[model samples]
Target: MAETVSHHLGKGRLVAVEGSLQISKSEKDGRTYTNPQVIANEVRFLDWPKDSKKGNGQSAGYDDDNFDVPF
Candidate 1:
């Protein structure tokens, strides 16, 4: 199963995180440096509401708002 990460939909707290982190690297004069690389990252969900519409999670077979029936 694919890993999932979920943050607090309210107070913006971390709920879960599953993934590998990769740090950035730089090359200069055939040398590499990794001091200023990213150490960690956090995923958060803020825009999505806490309660979403209940349905089959599928798009309706109607375009009532998108367009009219092309007869």
Candidate 2:
């Protein structure tokens, strides 16, 4: 299912997704754990950024260099 969505979304597209949450419990090694899951129901594509080609011909929001700043 995710593969199909990824294919439709393509490489550089953005989407607003809607989904439902599922909660489950499991016991492992005498310990109980709660897990939450997201089940995707709908996805709406958003417009591409205007400065998509500013950096390296990729979207400005997706530039790898944006995360290179030193703290």
Candidate 3:
């Protein structure tokens, strides 16, 4: 299955995702346990990219020549 999300990204906008794997420790009843997990450290909106869209008239790697898209 597929899902859709709507967001406003103008000509100049930045987006980023950062994640890492680390060990997590927990204590229960004077006993300690360790678990490893993958974590998303940050999602940063730093700066705009010179080109987020790919080459040619199509944006997001879709062919815009065939159909007219209203945006």
Candidate 4:
């Protein structure tokens, strides 16, 4: 399932996470609870700040002209 969390989503980047819900039963209270666990599968950068000097010195925004493809 694809779920979006406020803390995980941000500007200039995209995050793809995969995981499943974990169900556990407590021995003390005999109560059942569900927890969500996720792992990052892939990350693709969509944009960045123009003045930001970070990550290979690439500027912000989408630029397809300079994009390189490997066969």
Candidate RMSDs in Å, in order, are 13.8, 11.6, 11.6, 8.9
lDDT of 2 by residue, 15-66 (tens): 7668788999999999999999977776554544445556454554344443
Per-model TM-score, in order, reads 0.23, 0.44, 0.26, 0.29
What is candidate 4's lDDT per residue for 1-71, written digit by digit as tens? 12323322356554333434455544446766655444444333444434554465464333546322111
lDDT of 1 by residue, 14-47 (tens): 2333335566788999999875432224443323
Candidate number with greatest lDDT: 2
Instruction: Give the per-residue Cα lDDT of candidate 3 at 70.
Output: 28
The TM-score obtained by model 2 is 0.44
Q: Rate the local accuracy (lDDT) of all candidates.
A: 0.37, 0.58, 0.46, 0.41
Q: Any idea how many clashes model 1 has?
A: 0
Looking at model 4, residue 3 earns an lDDT score of 34
